[model samples]
Target chain A: MRYVLIGAGPAGVVAAETLRKADPGGDILLLGDEPEPPYSRMALPYFLVGTIDEAGTYLRKSETHYDDLGITFRHARAVRIDPAGKTVALEGGESVAYDRLMIATGSRTQRPPIPGIDLPGVHPCWTLADSREIVRRAAPDSRVVLMGAGFIGCIVLESLIKRGVKPTVVEMADRMVPRMMNAAAGGLIKKWCATKGIEVLTSTKVTAIEDTGEARDPLRVLLDRGAPLRAALVVVATGVRPNIAFLEGSGIETDFGIRVDSHLKSSVDDVYAAGDVAQGPDFMGGWSVHAIQPTAVEHGRIAALNMADGNASYQGSLAMNVLDTAGLVSSSFGQWQGVESGESVERMDEARFRYTRLEFDGERLVGAICLGRTDQIGMLRGLIQSRVRLGDWKARLMEDPQRISEAYVASTHK
Target chain B: MLKSLHIDPGKCTLCMQCEMACSYENEGLFNPAKSRIKVFDFHDRFVPYTCTQCAEAWCMSACPVDAISVDHATGAKVVSDDLCVGCKVCTIACPFGTVNYNHDTGKVIKCDLCGGQPACAEACPTGAIAYVDSDWTGYDKMRRWAGKTDSGAAQAHA
Candidate 1:
């Protein structure tokens, strides 16, 4: 069988490799739009921090990984996919036919319409090219105005701090990481950043950005309130949306992303979707796109198994995020925000910047948020994923949540 | 035949020799905190745990850099320290919490089964740990049950 996969990111790469393993003699072709080898976008932050080189961002270290596996890799952008004809049209007016197709075209940065956003010094921290531009301009002691305080923003904030730049973070939300953390948790993060000498402006918006006509610091950031700040560079970390524009009018279904069932099959037969572009089943009983690396990896494997006719059913993607802002680590799992009428318990130590919050639906741990603690953190995912009944341990945990490891072993081992 | 470490908590004395052996073999130190194999004390019972070397390793899959790979000879998921950027994504991806980050080295570490001869099993004084057949980890318990059944059959004949 001839298999064609698009977007050589993590999802595409994993699917290609898995297809090779499952169907040893199948013809597999992987298409990547970028010129460089298959590299991870998640590793771009490390590249920006000068921790790893361009080659280090590669998903496979070996130079002949695809070649050795007998899988063809090409640098081609897919413009359109015709499911009925079993052909994918390329931008250069070329069409490739395939028996099975995978749409792993991941998300792209959502660039908001702000004045002067298309300037030279303003860039989004998304791809490897963006990191190269950021490294070239973001010098030490230079002023940088970071836009948005979501998960991506917080990560870029850490990288900027490591580069010794004087960064002023501007967020439209009331607190940092509004989508990932609750008010209490996000406030603590804001407080922690303040202690580290970062000037964070929450509940504020950047109205416009203008060129200063100066060489040293050229960008003038005008916010809704306060004085205009002079910045050498402005990094946008707003958010991302799936790259499903090409699927329009392709007779493929889409809702925020291409809708796929447990088998990861798209509306059309012989076509499947994975990664950030596929809005599959969520662990909380609905369909939503989980734009995280772990989910992407899981989705790729499951989709490939089904594509190889292995008959694997995905058990939904769990929503999990682990972020290390500067040196403090914070993580949230599943339904971190408590459900309606669900019991919730939280403990906060502001002085130490340690916090723990647990949300429960009946006896099961529906969700949890943890900060300043890394020991046995995976147990939270295990408990929520296993859906193990806590029984008497629920009351014990409400009293002292620190005994989570003990609770996990006792409840799950039996 | 491929072998794996079989840990019996009943025979454990909590001597902590396994931890020291693991650290020395892997890190060239005698510190328990640096040991890949950890013994957890539940106040009543002490249990030793390490990487199970799952057939479908999640840490290997979740790694963005492809730094984690299987050691073909030993079937252990080994992390190449040179390639690791200290991302710590694998630590959270592992559901068992076996993969841990070393602050001193800025790289994550896990059990590599000490090449093929596991140091934890060798240093175990009470036979609580043993390197046994990977395919038949339940052979010992099954043999004991067979002996009990054989004795009952002889008694019935008498």
Candidate 2:
């Protein structure tokens, strides 16, 4: 029983470990396009900011541990997969056969189509190499032009501030983290960023990057409406797309990402997809969504269990985003919009830049967002996950998240 | 008679409790990147390396301004930032790459055992790290095996 897993990111590594644990006698092989072991993609910004060293991003257990567990790690790029033959063809024209295969190829950062985009200083925070390259080019007092107000972009913005570099973040959207969070929460975060001396340009786009004559700083970015902003470094936090390019014509069936059933098995037999690549049913809405690390990890674990002959079905994916920026913690779970027709409850203090919103569809919490005081995110997250009814404690939950969380927990006992 | 601080790499999860502890103790903030004791992770190897607080201190000898001195009580090499010229000689002298120069403050920084009690060991959730006595640091491992191997019934079952 040979288990071959592609992409040595978090999902791949967790799947391999889960498979090893479930079936110890089975042979497990983990392959990654990057030359290094799996690292925490979330920590790359911190590394770029000098808050963590280059090697600190590694999340995978050392290579020696993998060897001890009898997991073969092939450090190479997997270019093609033949589902019919049950084989994965490597980039260098080699093939590896597998009885069961898990595709956890994660995602790569999307680079917008703009001239001078191929310049040496342009970077994205999707991989360890990207972080290293960004850090090497960035120095104290370096002006950075970040093109996105997404969670990943804001994280990089915060990291630049920590590194004592001022970042001018240009977002075409009117608000920050628009996809994962609401306008009010985004406004709170934007105000916080302003207080930290970060210049955020909303509803703006970068038209072009002009090469400067100066030797010290080599780039000047032209905005849609404003004058050009001089910058030496640029970090594009503009989201990411699933690494599903290899599945072209393999007949696995992909919309934006590889579509999987509740069992995480793709349309093709003996094949399963998890992590950022698997787009499946929504936990609440039964819609397809992508790019949540926690969901991907859970997908891998469940897929591995079912692959090992254990009965496991992936319920669905809840849209969740957690951001730790400059000592400020922000988390959004479930739906951020009001399309679900939930009774919304909000607690806010504009001066402190703190806000909490709990949207309840009748009595059960459908979605929630927390800012400033995010220590209760874990408690509230469980509530959202369990879909517990707020009932009588709804008003009290707005005042203090802890109180409602406790009452909910207490009710569970009854 | 002096004792030096030792770290067990196997116990380190790279959570950076030590770095935070050191930074907060010295700089009044929670900044690990600025801390003296840096945890180096070999991602491929799954190991973290930190300062060993050597008995024969090379960093102490490398200091031209005599800013880095050996604490008689703890056998720990302490850096006097006021006297440090920031020449970074101590950084070059250390064999283990434990000693580092902070470009922000223009001085060299290294682990000083948190003035005899390390907060990192205290903050560690999984006791992968500990600030043990210099002489008997291996006692924890001995105790672990003792519980497993000491029982006569256990050995018979094995």
Candidate 3:
């Protein structure tokens, strides 16, 4: 059986590797749209920080890694996929047949509706090309404007700062990293960023980016709540949406992202979707596209196993966000928004930037958010994911949430 | 020059992000018990424990089947999981107590620095954990020693 994997990002690369290992005799074809070798997008920050070169971002270091595994790597974008015939048509009218199809096309950066967004000085910090463009313009003391202060934006913020650019970050949210962090946690992050010399404008939006008509530095950005800022380069890290446009009317179901079942199989036969593009089940018992790398890896592994062996099933994915903004770390784990009637407890030290908010439903921890309290993150994640009852320890946790490690040890020791 | 994970107990906030990242990289799952890097919390401070990739290299000397070998690129002692016999000899031989056995894989596992780019160091938000030149671990300990000796301007002015 020939297995065709699309979009050679983390999901596709892992899928191809998993498939090759699972079925050595099967024909495996991995297609990537980019010209570069299959690299980890997660390592893009490391690349921008000069710790590693562009080649270091590659998933496999050896040039002949794919060839040695007998997995064919092709550089092509899938324009259309016909699940009925299991044929994928490429951009140049080329078609490839496969017995099993893995859709791991990943995501694309979202472009907000703002005037002058298509200008030369403006770009998205998503791909290697964008990183190169950013490094070129974001020289030391260069005025860089980042449009969003969300998750991806904060990640890029570190790289931009490390590159010695004093970036003016503009976010529409009331606080930074709103999606991953709560109001208080997000506010603390914003304060930390301001302390680190980054000009953060919360509750602000970029209305337009006008050209200064200069060749060297030519961008003047207009904001909703602030003064017009001069910019050498404006990075629009607004957000990302899955690449599911091609699957429209292709008989596959899509809700924000391509819909896949527990087995990572699409609605149609033998066709599967994984990674950012797949709307798989959430650990909370719903469905959503988790664009995180860990989830994508799990999706790829399980999806590959299911396709090759058809005995594996996914237990759903938990929404886990671990972020570092200029050295202040914060994380959110599973249903952090809290369940109704759940007992919530918080310990905040705004002065020290240390905080922890635990949400417990009856006897089990449904969610948790910790700012400056990162060491307890692993235990909190285990507690939430395992859905283990806090039992008599629940009272102690309610009394002092900082005793999470004790609780974890006590409950699991037996 | 080779580098090692220099962990400052005081700098750690006990996030355990390093542990999760290490476990995921080595075990393909986010299981902390499976994690090579263990973060011990003593309430007053947090200490992150992991393989030192030791200069003396006791684990290397203890390995009988030669499963534990140094990765030439990273100067890390990476265990060849395929060749390991699960004897647990290195686990006892290592003075630092970093190397341990993995019951799931029936092989010993430890931090291999992720083949030079350690996920633990990369995942660490604070400078609590750093992959610095082994020769320079003393540099952080005596941070301003050279500056004091050279000019003595900042401290000598008093």
Candidate 4:
């Protein structure tokens, strides 16, 4: 059997490895668009901070990992996939026939249609190439204007601080990580950044970026409100959308992303989807795109299992985001925003920048948000994923949200 | 034969010998805070917890850099300190909360079962922790039950 996986991101690389393990005799081909080795985009921030080199960003450290597994990894981009013909048309006029195909083409950075966004100093902190440019331009004590204080924006902020750059974060949303974090949590993050001397402008938009016609400080960032900020570089962290333009008219059902079933199978036969591009089942109930790495990894494994003829079903992707903004760690899991008619409990110590909020759907914990706490945080995911009835522990947790470890042990052990 | 750590929390007396041993063996320090294995006090009881070395390890799979790998000799999912970029993705990915980030070193750390001879099992004063057969961790209990139900019919047949 010939197996073909497009996009050599985490999901694609994992799917390729899993397929090799599951079907040792099957012919596997992995296609990546970039010229570099299959690397983790998540590691780009670390790379920008000079914590790790480019080699450290690679998914597998060994150069011949894929070759040793007998998986042919080629640097090629899939322009179109003919589901009916079971063939994938490449960019350079080549078609590869496949018995099983995996659409793991991950999301691309969403470039907002702001004027002068294509300026030399203005760049999105998405790929390794972007990080290289950012590293060269973002000098110590240099003023850097950061756009979009979302999850990626917060991460880039941390990297910028590590590089000793004066960062001014501008978010169009009311708070930082508005999509993932609640108002209180987001406000706390902004306060924490302020304490660290990082300027975070919430509920603000970048109207335009103008070239200053200077070599050192080359960009002028015009905001919707307040005075225009001059900076050496401007980083865009707007967001990302699924790379599903090629899947258009391919008979694959798409709503925001290519819709997949519980088995990660696409609308077409002998084809599957995983990672950011697949709008798979959400842990809460309906279908939603979970663009997190954990979800992508889980989706890849499950999809590979199903592709190998092994009966496996995905339990849906949980929305989980963990961010470190200039030394303050924050995490939100599942439905952080409380569901309709659901009871919620919160404990905030703004002085210490410690906070915990738990959302409950009846007796079970449906969601949680934690800040400045890392001890046994995974228990939150465990408790939420297990869907174990908290019983009396629910009341106990409502009284003290910090008793999560105790509650998890009590509920799960029983 | 492949061996695994069989932990009997019921036999534990909360001596914290396992923690010290684990920290000393891995980190070259006798600090329980730096220990990979932790003994959590639950007000009434203390339970020693560490990596169970899952068959389908989530920490290994969720690692973006493939830093976590299974030790061929021990079957323990070990994190390469050099390769781990300290992303902490494994810390959140682990459902059991075994993998933890070491702030001092800026890398994630987890139980590696002490290569093959587990320090926690060796240091346990009471036999609460034991490195036994991976497949037959309950063989001793099963043997005890067999001894309890021993009848002369088996001897007669033999």
Each model's fraction of native contacts? 0.33, 0.00, 0.00, 0.38
In candidate 2, list every pair of residues with a backbone clash.
A62-B45, A62-B46, A63-B44, B11-B128
iRMS per model in Å? 12.2, 20.0, 22.1, 12.2
| CA deviation > 4 Å runs, candidate 2 | A398-402, B1-158
| Tens digit per residue, CA lDDT, model 2, A282-301 | 76747475576556666777
TM-score of each: 0.94, 0.72, 0.75, 0.94
Q: What's the distance in Å from true for residue A119, model 4? A: 1.0
Choose the strongest candidate by DockQ: 4
Residue B157 lDDT in model 1?
21
True contacts kept of 3: 0.00
lDDT of 3 by residue, B36-154 (tens): 88787656767776666654354654443446678888888988775554445455344344676655554677779998888888898987889888876632422232221111112
lDDT of 2 at A316: 73
- Candidates sorted on lDDT, descending: 4, 1, 3, 2
Task: Show what share of the native A-B interface contacts model 1 retains.
Answer: 0.33
Comparing 3 with 4 on lDDT, the higher-scoring candidate is 4
Instruction: Please give the lDDT score at residue A260 for candidate 2.
Output: 88
Ranking of models by TM-score: 4, 1, 3, 2
